[model samples]
Target: MLQYIIKRLLVMVPTLLGVLTITFLVTQFIPGGPVDHMLAQLDGHGARSGADTGESATGGWSYSGRQGIDAAQIEQITALYGFDKPPLTRYWEMLKNYVRFELGDSYYHHQSVASLIQEKLGVTVSLGVWIFFLTYLVSVPLGVAKAVRAGSRFDTVTTLIVLVGYATPGFVLGILLIVLFGGGSFWDIFPLRGLTSDHWHELGWGGKILDYLWHITLPVVASVVSLFAMKTLLTKNMFLEEISRQYVLTARAKGLSERQVLWKHVFRNTLLPLITGFPATFIGAFFTGSLLIETLFSLDGLGLLSYEAINNRDYPVVLGTLYLFTLIGLLIKLLSDIAYLFVDPRIKFTAQES
Candidate 1:
């Protein structure tokens, strides 16, 4: 076990370097700097003014300057961030700084990246937790039902629902839900947003929760449907496969009841595959949430944070967040491999024998 752990840890070095390289290259492809994202739209407006009234008409303020990133500003930013240095030197510096957990500043927001992360982490964490718990609460029972009823009307209906949930894009789903639920035209159940009211702090604790729930109701429903559908389908397929195994047949032939055959013999083994997929699902959900569900719902999570960072060319925060999320995901996958031994007796038996 110790050797296995050491081996995994050793593998992380190259993985981290690879992550850094990929992030750096990908970010370079996006057009503009932080200044550009803010000012690019203003170029045409400024150009019209320049055409009507010459540059000298506005105290020599050249309105018809470059339409994209300010080259001078970009150069300064590049030099400041050591983009002007040798790539190898910068890479080493990045590796060293990250080792000390110094992720640097948010150039866009003019704040420490760490502090910015601390500020917005609560909402994303809270939403992720609630959605995960709700998903499991609903999915487990539904998965079991689908497994038991394999090809019946119940399974067919559920399979179709899951497929649709998986197919639907998060932004489309989010907008549709807000229109249906938060617009007050349909059920008239909740607010359009998914956070506490503006005066949320002034309310009593119970009142606060109530109001928060009201706002989050639509977002939560959207999140749960997308999340639960995938988990339920995976668990159902695993359970179905397990139910037909020779051991399950033997248990039934031994006069074991349907419940006993399922619970004691089938469910346990079925959980092995599910357990293997668990870490990837959890980690992928964390990163993709920034791009999808969180973005649409206006949740101030790491996902939204990354989006803002990219748009504003806040390289430090963007790179820092990317590395953190990637590191977490890679580690989770590694651990999942190890967890399989505990989840399956055959794996444990092989390890012990070795």
Candidate 2:
């Protein structure tokens, strides 16, 4: 196992570089640099922009809108943020930078990426834990019921509901939820934004924690609701596969109770496959919440941070967040493989080596 782990860790290097290479190339190709995003945001004020305000028009100490930033300033800005050089040079720089564990300064937040991640860790981690618990508990029961009922009315109804849940994106669901639950006649009842009530600062830690939970419930629910169908379907498929196996049939032939056969022989194995996907599911949750739910609900997580970074053209934050997320995905995939040991020892890693 130690040797296996070492081999896997070794593979992570090239795997990570490949992931980052694609990310860097794709992100750089995205339209709208800092200047464009800044101007666009200012234009969204629904009033006279800098152009209309006669600043750029009269050459009175203003950028030329999208071209507003003069060359010297642009050069200085680029140098300051390490965007002044060719892409290859900057790429090499970034590789060395992160290898040294320096994530660099966020042009958007004006802080180190690590510092920003630390500050926002609370809200993101809180939301992740909540959704993980909620999704796990929910999907398992629903999956078991669907598997048991197979072709019954309950199964048909649930399958259709899962379709609907999958059809709606998390962000849109978040907006709809807010409209119904967060922003209806009782918007204030749920604390529409932030992780806690304003008075939480004055309360005891436990009180503040309870208040935080109350506030995060809606956002977390919206997130989990969007994911319900997905986890359920994955679990259902796993159970289906396990039930068809010969072992399950043998257990049933022994006159064992259906519940006992399903839970003991079936679930123990089926759930291992499910566990392999759990890490990916959690990573996907971070992305699903990134723009829609976090932005609409105003939670200060990586999602909201990334959104602001995008709108502001903060390349450091954008690229840094991208690296962080991609690394997370890869690490979790590794973790999932390790977890397979606990879930099923009969499963041999060497089997896949060929």
Best by lDDT: 2
| Each prediction's whole-model lDDT (CA) | 0.72, 0.76
Quote the positional error of residue 10 for candidate 1 in Å.
1.5
Models, CA RMSD each:
5.7, 4.8
Backbone clash pairs for candidate 1 read 290-303
Q: Which stretches of candidate 2 lie over 4 Å from their true place?
A: 26-75, 83-87, 185-188, 253-255, 351-354
Best by TM-score: 2
1-354 in candidate 2: lDDT tens per residue?
A: 777888888898898798778878876666666544444444442233456655432112222354544667656655676656798998998889877767888776678988998898777887788788788898988998898778889999999988888788777877677777775654545767888887888999899878987888778877787778877988888888889999988998999999999888888988786787688678866665555667678877877777767656677777777777777877888888888988789877764654
The all-Cα superposition gives candidate 1 an RMSD in Å to the true structure of: 5.7
Task: Give the Å shift of residue 21 in candidate 2.
Answer: 2.9
Over 1-354, each residue of candidate 1 has an lDDT whose tens digit, in order, gives 667778778888798889888887676555554434334334553334445556433212233345476778666756765567776786678778899888887776778888888888777776666676777778877898899999999999998998898787666787788677655456666666448778999999999989988777766677667777778988898888888789888998999999998877787787776677667567644565545677666677777788767655678898888778777777887777788777664664225653
Model 2 weakest lDDT span, ten residues long:
55-64
| Predicted structure 1, TM vs. truth | 0.81
